[model samples]
Structure formats: C-alpha cells, structure tokens
Target: MKEWSVLLLSLTAAAFVLFAGAGTASAADGGKILIAYFSRADENYQVGYVEKGNTQVLAEAVAEATGGELFRIETERPYPKEYRETTEVAKREQNEGARPKLKSTPPDIGFYDVIFLGYPNWWGDMPMAVYTFLESYGSGAFAGKRIIPFCTAAGSGLSGTVGTIGKLCPGATVNNAFTMLGAEAQEFSDGTRAKVREWLVGTGLVK
Candidate 1:
C-alpha cells in the first residue's frame, strides 16, 4: 500500500509539471499587443461634424476589444483643420513623397509583440504622417513583430496599404487588413462596434 501511494504521488507530480509547462508555453506564444493609429478630428467625408477621426474611433474600438495599449501618431506640424485644405496638403505630400515629421511615437515600440496599425485612407493611401511614423522607426525596426493593418476610407478600400506596410517594415509579419467605411466608423451607433468586433474575431485576436 505504501509503494502504491508513492507511485500515485509521483504520477500526480508529473501531471502537474506537464500542465504547468503547457500553460507556460501558451503564455510565451501569446504576444503583447499595441494599437498605434494616426487620426484626424476635423472635417471628414460622408460623416459630417465628427469630434473624433473615423480611424480614431475604430482604433478605440479595437483597443477595447483586444485590451491593447493605444498610441496616437501625431505630426509635428498639424495639418489644415479644414477638410478641403487637408486634402490638398495630403495630396501634395503624397506627390512629393514627403515624410512629415511625427510629433510623437509608440512608447517602447520594440516591446510590443503585435502592433495594430490604424489610419485613414487619404487619396486612396495612408496619410503622409503615417509614413513619417513608419520611417522614424528605421529599417528592420519591426523585424520580428506582427503588424495588423486597419483603415477607414470614404470609398477606396485599403488601396494597397497592406503591401506598402509590408514593404516599409521588412521582415515583419503583416497579417490580414481590415477596412471600414468612414461613414460606418463615424456613425458607430449604427453597428460600428459590432463590425469591429466581428473583424477582431475574424483576425483571431479576440474570441
């Protein structure tokens, strides 16, 4: 009976070690998350008079859904407050391939394992400020991290921004991209959160 008891104890200890190892493995595989976005708050298309930028609203939704830290990418020189003026400036920047100086950057950028990059589609591409932010990180800065792109657009969806990001952040894993209409994001009360949640689930970022 004593020998049997010792045998049972040994088995129990082995099971506990196996279970603990499995839990540790799962934790190691689960990466830290960050939501970085460049958003505009003034005039926008489709949705009139919004206090928050369309991409900002969606980025907030993603942060809420995933419990990721939020980082706003700001430009050193603020863009024109008026929508039309902003569009012109954006167009000029894109045409010139100008990288506007970023006012702020992600905190401890290298610490985050998964980065959710959000921005508004400007003239069928991501805003120039976003490009500045990406370039600020330098080459191979996002080497081993996972990048998930999300965007808000009036009509043009994504506009090949995913490929652009892949090119910018060489060696980084760019996952599936999500694009939501500007109107949907602004009129969030009209099932915007639901759509964001659905996309998060689809991305396997949330249950």
Candidate 2:
C-alpha cells in the first residue's frame, strides 16, 4: 500500500511539472502566438445577422486551432454607440490621421515568434488601434520572425494593410494573411476551422 501511494505521488509531480513546462514554452515560440485583435464589443451588423463583436469569435477559433494565446485589442475611448455614428467617427479619425489609444498592453513580444493580427475593416483600411499597437513595438525587436494576419472585413479585403504592417516592421517576415466576414464568423463552422488548421500547418507554424 505504501509503495502504491509513493507511485501515485511521483506521477502527480511529473504531470504538474510537464504541464507547467509546456505553458512556459508556449509563451516563447510564437507558438504562443498572441491573437491580438481589435474587436468592438458593440452593435455590429452583418450580412443577415447582428453581432456584438466578430473579431472575438474569429480570434478564439484561431487560438484554439493553433494552440496559441488570445488577446483583445480594446480602446481606452470606446467607439460610438450607433453604427452610422461609429462609421462617421472612424472616417473622420482616419482622415485626420488619428491614433486611438489602446486599453490593453500587448503580450510580451519576447514570448511570441509569430503574431496573428486581426481586426474589423474600418473605412478602407485597418482600424487606428492597430497602428497604435505597431507604433509601440516597431523597433525591429521581432526581426526574422514571422507574422500571420487574419481579419474580419466588410467590403474591403486586406486593402494593403499587410503592406502597411511590413513597412512599419521592416524586420519581420509577414505572410499567411487571410480574411473572413462577420456573418460567416457567426457560424464558427468546422470548415472555417479546417482552413485555419491548413494555414497554420502550411505556414509551418504548427503540427
């Protein structure tokens, strides 16, 4: 009986250490790829449905598929409440070259090799929050590392957003860019997840 108890205790300790170690490694390889995305937690109109936020759903799926970390890119000053008003604000801000302050600090770039950036299409480009995130970490820190971006766009595709990011971080290798609409994200289907898996595998970022 004493021998059995000792065996069980040893197994428990080993399991704990292994899991803890795995967590540490994940945060380091960009295998811990942080899902940094700008998703407003407000009224979002899709093709046929309404969503509070679409980026969150997409980011969650990507994180699950890639076994990575998930982080929300929120604004210190929230967007307008009404949809039309929000669009107006976004347009004016874009024209004036305004950068919205983010409420969250990005995850440790030291911990990630690949970063999956996502956001809803604002105007004909990325939201200003993304620019803010880039400005904070644009000093060639993650050079030679890969950055994979995905988005939930409305009318526009990537719309030269990837190029903009590349220009911002000249040291990073950017690829594996993709997009999905908000209404499509609402389903969270297996097909969408399969595509995600393929992208991760194809990029050689995961098994």
Candidate 3:
C-alpha cells in the first residue's frame, strides 16, 4: 500500500512536468508573445488630460491573460521622485536627444516569437529609455520578429513614434499599434480585455 502511494505521487509529478513542458513549447511557437514596457511613477498625460502611472496598470492586465514575461525599463538615471520636478526633467531630456541608460535588462528575450512593446507617449513619442533599449538591442536580435506596440498618452496618438521605430529598427515587422488615453485605462473593463484577446488571436499568439 505504501509503495502504491509513492508510485502515485511520482506519476503525478511526472505528469505535471510534461504538461508544463508542452505549454512552454506552444508558447515558444506561434503562441508566444513577450511584453516589454516602460512606465514612470511620476506623471503622464491622457487625452488632453493629465494622469500618472496608467501605462503600468495596463501592462499588468495584458500580461496576466497572455502569461508573458514583463520587463520594466528602468533608467540608470532615475527621474525626479516628484511629479512636477519629473516633468521638468522629462522636458529637458526631450530638448536634448537623451537616452537615459536603463538599469535592468530583459531576461533572455530570445525565448519569445513575438514582442509586445508598451510605453506612455512622451513629447509625442516614446520615452528615451525606449530608444536606448532599441539601439542597445539593435535590429539583429529582433530581425524578422513581429512587433506589436501599445501605448497610452494625452491627445497625441501613436503619431511619429511608429515612424521613428521604423527608422530605428529598419528590418523588423511592425503591426498597427494601439494608443489608449491614459486616463481611460482604468475603464479597460471586460471589453478591453476581449480586444486584447482578439489581438492575440490575430497575431496567432493564441488558439
């Protein structure tokens, strides 16, 4: 009887390992999509309104359903802890072509088939850390990779950001990006989640 119990536990463990391995393989194939985003705790603008930290909340929801890894792009030079002060710093960085160094790197980005890039729109474009990230990785590691970009901001839509990414990573495939007003992010609701599911299905990242 004791022997039988041990055998049952061993079998259960083995089954779990096999199941997990299969899941990873499917995700590695057409089902895998990675989420890489940068969000600041200080300040943001949304649909001609002002807000703070909406992009971070949105990314968490997206990653939950997809079961994808989330990497926050942090800068070596931290932005001001105060919102007003941070806004001033951001404006200055925008004035100069600034690429604040990132302190953290994505863990083994080579594992995913598709990449979902997210960020809050700043100065009608992506934050400089994004530029730093792209330039650091270059077009080699991501060559032929399918990229999906999603962002939140004030009234400014994706605008020149996509164009700029095109210029930066010349050889990658980019899909039509989505821009959500940061202030509206709290209302993502069930409908917004459904839209994300639709996107995953369209990208062949889900069954």
Candidate 4:
C-alpha cells in the first residue's frame, strides 16, 4: 500500500510540472502587446454626440482583453465637430495625400513585439492622422513585429486597411483585421467587448 501511495504522488507531481510548463510556454509565445489607435469624439455617424469616440471605445476593450498599453493618436488640429464637415476634411486630406501633424510624440514602438492598431474608417480608409503616426515611427521600427488591425466603421468595415498596413510596414507581419460597426461599438459596448475577446482568442493573442 505504501508503494502504491508513492506512485500516485509521483504521477501528480509529473502532471503539475507538465501543466506549469504549458502555461509558461503560452506566456512566452504571447509577446508584449501595444494598442495604438486614432479616435475622434463629437457628432459621429449613427452614434451622435459621443464623449468617447467609437474607435476609442473599441480600442479600450481590446486593451482590456489583451492587457496591452493604450496610445491615442491625435492630430495637432482637431477635426470638425460636425459629421459632414469632418467627412469633407477627411476627403480633402486623402485627395491631397496629406499627413496631418500629430499632437504628441509616439511611444517607443521597439519595446513592443505585437502592435494592435485601431482606427475609425474614414471615406473607406484610415484617417490621415494615422498615416502621420505610422510614418513617424519610420519603416525600420516595425521590422519583425506582428501588426493586428481593428476598426470601427459605419459600413466600410476594415476597408482593405490591412493591405495598406502591409504596404506601409513591409517588414512587419500584418495579420487579418477585425472590424465592427461604429454604432455597435458605441451602443453595445458589452457585446463589443465579448466579441473582441473572442477574436483575440482566435488570433492567439488571448487564451
């Protein structure tokens, strides 16, 4: 009976070691994450007069799920508070290929192994400020890093922004993008969070 008891104890210890090793392996594989996004508050499409922009809400949920650091991308000159006026400004910026000046210095992106970029889809593309943010880092900063994009849009979804990121950061591994309606993100925050968590799990960012 004593020999049998010793054998059971040995099996339990082995199981514990195996499980612990797996947890460590998972943590090692999941590198440090950073959630950087551009969001605008005020009169927005669908959800009007928001203090927190739709993209900001979504980005915050992503940060919560992945435990990533949050960085907001703001322009030196704010966009119009009115939705129509903002769209016009966005269109002009895109037509001119303009790079709006950023309001703050960017974080040291070299410290993060994974970067989750979020923005609101404007005129079927990322806002011009996001362009400035990416270009500010220079192409070399993103080399060998994993970039995952998410967006809140009216109807454009990701609007092929994932491909654009690949073009901009050629050395970085750009993963598939996740997108949701701005209204859904703004109005149904709890559901949005759940969906974001599920998507993160599929992307291997969360378990």
Candidate 5:
C-alpha cells in the first residue's frame, strides 16, 4: 500500500511539471501583447458607411484571439466623413510627411513586449496619424520589442508599410504583416475570425 501511494504521488508531480512547462512555453512565445490600431469609419471604400471601421474589426479579432489590450489611435482633428475627401486628406498628409496630433495620451508602451500594430493602408502606406502614435512614445519606447503588423485595404494589401515600420523603429523586430480586404473585415464573418485565429497560431501567439 505504501509503495503504491508513493508511485501515485510521483506520477502526479511529474504530470504537474509537464503541464506547467507547456503553459510557460506558450506564455513565453506570446509574452504581453498589445493590439494597437488606427481605424476610421464613415464612407470607407468598398464598405460604404460603417459604424465601425474595418481595421477596428480586425484588431478586435486579434485582441480576442491573443487576449491583448486594444488601443485605438485617434487624431485630434477627425477626418472627413466622405471617402473621397478623406483619401485626399490622407494623400496630402503623406505627400508632406505630416504627423497629425493624437486625440488622447497613449498608454505606457514599455509594459508590453509585443505590439500588434494595425491600420488601414492609405495611399500605399500607414496613415500619418499612426506615425504620430508610434513616435509619441519616444525614440526608445519600441526598442527590443516585437512588432506584428496587420492591415485592411481595398486592394493594396500591406504595400511597403512593413519595411517602413522596420525603418522607423530601428531596434524593433518587425514580423511579416497580415492583410485582408476592407470589405471582408468590415463584415466580421466567421471566416474572418477563423483566418485571424490561423494567423495567430502561425505567429505562435495562439495554440
């Protein structure tokens, strides 16, 4: 009876360690994640007028899968409700390399180890307001952090924004970006969620 009890106790201890190690490995790969995105609603391309932006929907899916905090990057001056006008404004901002002012103070980015940056691809690049958000945290905030880029666009996909982010944050690791059509993201369908989950698994952020 005593020998049987000892064997049972040893098995239980070994099982506990094995499961604990597996959990630790998953956490180490994911770390602390933040889903930071810049999204705009109202008369967006493909998805006409919407209450929620496409990129916002995608970011929310990412947040759900990874259990990451969501941060919306907003501008002090809101963009035009009209799609054409917004495009023109975005183009002009890009042309002049403008950094639009942020609406609210950003959270302390130093607490997070992984930043999942999402945005709408505007004129083959990230919106200028995102530029403001990235730089707002100071030059060293993103140092040694892992940045995962995601975007929603009409057809441009990620364009050259991935490379741009790598250049902007010299010390950060910019991973391959994930992108989807704005219309698809706006719909927020089961397929969209599945795709997001698969992508998260590939990144080792989800099991």
Candidate 6:
C-alpha cells in the first residue's frame, strides 16, 4: 500500500511539472505561430479578383512577418461568385447564426501557440466559415493560445468582430485587433505591407 502511494505521488509531481512547463512555453519566443484566414477570391466589391483576395494578401504578410504557418479557413460549399449575391447569403447566415462546414483544418492545430486569425468584415461580423473553424474542435479550441485578429473591410473597421471572437473562443487570449480597408489593400500594396509589418511588430510577435 505504501509503495502504491509513493508511485502515485511521483506521477502527480511529474504532471504538475509538465503542465507548468507548457504554460511557460506558450509565451516564449513567438511560439509556433499559425496564421489562419478566410478569404473570398471571386468578384469582390470595388476590387475585382486581380489574382488574390484582400484578406489573403494580409494573411501572407502576417505569415512572412512572423514565420507563421498559414491555414485557410475555407468552406466545403463555396459562397456565391458575385459579390452582391455573397453578401445577401452572408446576411442570412449571420441572422441564423450558421456554422458552414469547413474544407479542412491544420493537421497539428494544437501545436500552435500564437494564432493570427484573419477575415473580412461581413455585415459587421466575421464570415460564418470563421465560426466553423472556431467551433471545429469543440469548446476551448483556442484555449492557451494568444489570438490576434486582422481584417480587411471597405469601411467597417473590425466591426466589433474581435469581441465576437472572444465569445466564440471562451478561453483564448484575444488581443486588440488590426483592421485595413479592402480597397487600400488592392490599390496600395506597399502601404498595406508597411501597415502589416507595423502591426506585427506592435504585437511583439515579430521583430
């Protein structure tokens, strides 16, 4: 009986040490960055598909700045190709609180320590696909990771989407967000790059 108790005590001590070590690793040295973004590539508002989506451009910049892994949060069923049609559908989804099915997820999702979540502002909210990603692994999907939001919008800068993320990802360490105009992203690459770099540095995720 005494021997079993000693073994159990040793196991408990080992688990505590391991848990403490993981906590320290989470905030250490930009810790395994993951840049996850949802972008639409077809006919967009004002900016036609010149090759890439506005949010995609920002996602790439974030990956470059932080050496983060990129994960595109895509829908299994595609959205409408026309901008107006897509917006109409988006509105309905937002009203219904829809969770569209996703195409895929990162194989090593739990390995990421800092996640930079990017999306376009849709009806003052994130794409329904983004919610799918957040809820994919059940509750606490973003637990123990620092979540930094970046977004592109024509006018509605973030539109309180960051707060919505906090609601979705209950235990996530959600931080202040970065917002850029979609038109500016398409028209001014240099300026957008500078802004992305500045935001990454300000977040202390990149030097």
What is the Å distance of residue 169 in model 4 from its true position?
0.4
TM per prediction: 0.84, 0.79, 0.75, 0.85, 0.85, 0.83
C-alpha RMSD values across all candidates: 10.6, 6.3, 6.9, 8.5, 8.2, 13.9
lDDT of 6 by residue, 58-164 (tens): 88867655667799999889988889999999999999999998888644668888888999999998999998888777777778878999999999989889898
**What Cα-based lDDT does every candidate model obtain?**
0.83, 0.74, 0.71, 0.85, 0.86, 0.81
lDDT of 1 by residue, 11-121 (tens): 998765432232221124547888899999888887766789999998887776676889999988988778999999999999999988888754877888888999999
Give the per-residue lDDT digits (tens) of candidate 2, residues 34-63.
Answer: 778887755676643345477788787667
Better of 3 and 4 by lDDT: 4
Tens-place lDDT digits, model 4, residues 1-207: 999999999999876543223232123677888889999999999888999999898787777566678999999899999999999999999999999999999999888888999999999899989999999887578999999999999887998799999888879998858999999989855566567666777777666
Best by lDDT: 5
Residues 1-207, candidate 5: write the lDDT tens digits: 999999999999876543223332124677788889999999999788999999998888777667788999999999999999999999999999999999988889888888999999999999999999888877777889999999999998999999999888879999957999999998878787677766777776666
TM-score of candidate 1 on Cα atoms, chains taken together: 0.84
User: Which structure is stronger by TM-score: 5 or 6?
Assistant: 5
The C-alpha stretches of model 1 lying farther than 4 A from their native spots are: 1-29
After superposition, the stretches of candidate 2 with alpha carbons farther than 4 Å from their true spots are: 1-31, 47-52
Ranking by lDDT: 5, 4, 1, 6, 2, 3
Candidate 5 minimal-lDDT segment of 10 residues: 17-26
**Candidate 4 global TM-score:** 0.85
- Model 3: residues with Cα > 4 Å off, grouped in runs: 1-25, 28-31, 43-52
**Model 4 deviation from the true structure expressed as Cα RMSD, one decimal place:** 8.5
Clash pairs, model 5 backbone: none
Q: Looking at model 1, which ten-residue stretch has the lowest summed lDDT?
A: 18-27
Q: Taking the tens digit of each residue's C-alpha lDDT, what string does model 3 give over 64-160? A: 6566777788898887656667777777888898988889875565676767788888777788888888888745777777777888877787878
Question: Counting only residues 3 or more apart in sequence or on different chains, how many pairs clash (N, Cα, C under 3 Å) in candidate 4?
Answer: 0
Could you arrange the candidates by TM-score from highest to lowest?
A: 5, 4, 1, 6, 2, 3
